[model samples]
Target: MSETIIAKRYAQALFHIGQERSKLEEFESELRTLQEVLRNNQALYSFLQHPRITLDQKKQLVNESFQSFSKEVIHTLNLLLDRHREEILSAMVDQFLTLMNETKGIADAKVYSVRALSEGEKKRISKTFAPKVGKQTLNITNYVDRSLIGGLRVRIGNRIFDGSVSGKLDRIERELVSNK
Candidate 1:
């Protein structure tokens, strides 16, 4: 099976387990923590995937590293490692968060602006754009991007609402070229 399909399957199974245990948010937190750890430590995955390392050794290392994590999360990690699906761990976490967000009627958005947005600005942007994407609310993460020149660009899922000056200029250039 493709890695994405496998990742989604694992994510769905974990999501269901979290639902059953009334720990969806807790699982999300744990998965995000795991994601952060994996992101920062490139060698960790290398160690897990090393040909000479045994599965038991990898599991033990994971268990020790994440001793504070819930049993379910640890078990899921061990299962993935056992199945040699370590590469899909990040994708699985992303899928799980996506599933949780869908259940909660929320969307994760990245807002790009030339300057840092204030809390009020973020709230107003969320209120204005969330419904456009059929979501109740947005969990907005603002990124200051000077390359935008001015204005904001919001991305949710596969959709992008580009109100940046650079974006507008590009659109106008395209229009002019097409008209020529």
Candidate 2:
């Protein structure tokens, strides 16, 4: 099976467990921290992937490093390590987060503006756009992009609502050229 398929399966199982235990948010946070560590530490990633290392040793290291994590998360890691599927850890976490967000009626959104947006601006954007995307609310992450010239762009999932000045100019230019 493809890595993504495997990851989704594992993620679904974990998501169910989280829901049953009423610890979905806790697991999501812990999983994100683990994913970040795996992403930022090449050596640790290699160590986990190394064939020479024993499973016990890898589990020991993982346990020591993530001692503060919940038992469910730690057990999941150990299970993955034992099965030699550690490489899919990040993907699993991402799928799990997606499931959690969907269950909570939340969507992750990216807001790009010429300048940093205030809390009020973010809230306004979320209120205006979240319903359009069939979500109750948006978890907005803002980015400052001077290239936008002015205004902002909002992306939720595969849809992008572009209100930037540059976007407007491009659309007008396209219409003018097409009319010729």
Give a tens-digit lDDT track for model 1, residues 17-80: 9999999999999999988988999999799889899999999999999999999999999999
RMSD to native for every prediction?
Answer: 1.6, 1.6
* TM-score against native, each model: 0.91, 0.92
Steric overlap count per candidate? 0, 0
Instruction: Write down the lDDT that model 1 would get.
Output: 0.95
Give candidate 2's whole-model lDDT: 0.93
By summed lDDT, which 10 consecutive residues of candidate 1 come out lowest?
45-54
Q: Rate the local accuracy (lDDT) of all candidates.
A: 0.95, 0.93
Q: Candidate 2 regions off by >4 Å? A: none
Judging by lDDT against the true structure, name the best candidate.
1
Clashing pairs in 2: none
Q: What lDDT is reached at residue 155 by model 1?
A: 97
